[model samples]
Target: MVTVLTSGLASSLMDRLRRAAMKLALGEQPPEDLPMIAALALADGLESPALVELAGLSRRDPPADIRDLFTEALAELGLPMPRVEEAWIDRMLDAARAMLSGSLSPYEASDEIYWCLCHLDRTDRVTEPMLLFAGLWSNWEDWPDGRPTIEQNMREAAADLLRSHGEQVSEHE
Candidate 1:
């Protein structure tokens, strides 16, 4: 009997994912509605780039179709978009000053002040970019509870989420 190694199992799974993605690409049916579908994929822990590519392959545009819904999603979670300019510096500086005087430490204040900048860095003004950006880079020291190498961790999280929802992540190319 031929013993299938772990790599063999992974290879088999990847092949299945490829087949599924190809099927979607060919069928042109796509997943369900846009935001929910994208949200579902996000919940499944799919990275932003993967999600974007998958969406492109599946031909879905949840965010574009429902800007209100996307905005609602972000607002519901109290996530603010970053708007940077010299005009805003005074306000930010004031907040920084207040934080400095208050119990918040410089490190904490700096983090809060740079939070939006970080968001800008992550998203490049794109909705899906932030998640993958954050998820991929979240394991760094600058990020909370970040480990040395957490790409696999992020992928596993995405996979587990998708699996729990009865969704499948196509073995990426």
Candidate 2:
């Protein structure tokens, strides 16, 4: 299992990603929505447009492996793919598969995924949503009685990020 210092921002983004991934996996949402949802989750980070573009590219040419898709997405966004150890990738893949198969809850899976992403970010020095979200999530936890407003702040930040990137972001509820 991967570990991360959870904060409100990280929790919110993880929730958003997990929900989007689940919805996509369950066929509740169209493939095109993935990037938009990712953009919303990532806010104004470098990964947002890349995710959106990745979804578009996936529609044109789907990759066989999800990891490949993720790599390609980052590359499409002009970001370098982090060099993660094969062992870590294998472990994450196993965990992710378990999550998709319903052996793990979305929350658990997202947390692990966040850690994996963080590991990659730390190793590569790249700016990714998972890394940023993890930091924010950790910082938020230090604040006194900050939970209630954190979610809203996260959304607003995401919206601001999207708008700054010239992408139209809509708040979900």
Candidate 3:
């Protein structure tokens, strides 16, 4: 068996790295490629076992297979490994649905939404529903456990935003 050793970057820490890459990609001057993104993360003083491994790869002679290495790193980091064009939007909607389904905590979802919105590339493509979601759902000062009505309202708003954005809500939802 040919066992592949991963950098073990698949967790919240790596998720933060993914957000950093997204922010950079959305920035005025995006990096040329994924390795540059990783390099910039290293330049930004973001360090981790996995990030360090990627950085080492960046220093290689000829830097052969950087794309492959970068892709592998993302996979190990539980990042947008599939590299689908819609991965970012899909992740946002999926995270929101998980929150509604009780699989993901509201606080985590709120944080993710806040981060996503702050880093989003605001262009003509942005819609009113996206704005509404950012204004309404991203910030929750106090999500009281006893208030089922409040949660329901949040869920409804999220569902509307998801539907407007073309995300299919679960049948049970």
Candidate 4:
């Protein structure tokens, strides 16, 4: 029970941090919840050096340099800080892998698929899982029976991709 709860908390924290980092990367202000998020990391006992650097900041102290440093800190914390393009691809890959692994549901995967397709062009980073995701998403309305085959293909492709290209989330998380 404790392990599950901790894993859930870490996953939640990683999501928040990733979103904030992406916004900063895109020349946007950090989320209003940034301070609270840092606090939660400390509360959860992740007192890593990178996090300590963040813990020293005042809410109003951020600037463009801060944006770079913020992403750098995430990298130091063992997060896979991808470029915006690769980030979407990574998210898509994660959704498929998690769905196959039973860590996420198809309902959740659908939302992930939608966001990835929105960000990604059809001509690039066309991984096998992406192809399967596109097919599964487009035909879900008319082909209920197709879910099994698509999911089966997804399971195989996602497993193979995960072996070679999956993000290595921090153990501290």
| The candidate that achieves the highest lDDT relative to the unseen native structure | 4
Q: Which candidate order results from sorting by TM-score in descending order?
A: 4, 3, 2, 1
Better of 2 and 4 by TM-score: 4
Which residue runs does candidate 3 get wrong by more than 4 Å?
1-66, 69-85, 123-131, 134-139, 142-147, 170-172
Q: What's the C-alpha lDDT at position 134 in model 3?
A: 54
lDDT string, candidate 3, 1-173, tens digits: 11232345334335555654444334422233545567665665444455555666544434345545555555554465433334456566766777778886655664555455544466644445456555545345444554465456557766765786887887556
- Winner on lDDT (2 vs 4): 4
State the weakest 10-residue window (summed lDDT) of model 2.
Answer: 78-87
* All-Cα superposition RMSD per candidate: 19.4, 15.9, 9.0, 7.1
Residue-wise lDDT of candidate 1 within 56-126, one digit each (tens)?
43334453444334333333323232234321332234334434345554344344444423433343432
Task: Quantify all predictions' global Cα lDDT against the true fold.
Answer: 0.38, 0.46, 0.54, 0.59
TM-score of 2: 0.28
Candidate 1 vs candidate 3, TM-score winner: 3
Instruction: Give per-residue lDDT, candidate 3, residue 41.
Output: 57
- Return the TM-score for candidate 1, rounded to 2 decimals: 0.19
- State candidate 4's TM-score: 0.60
Model 4, span 1-173: residue lDDT tens = 01123666666766666766655544454544455565666676554565655656667765544455565667766676567776666666767667666887664675575567567666554544566665666666558788776555545545554554654433221
Q: Report the Cα lDDT for residue 108, model 4.
A: 62
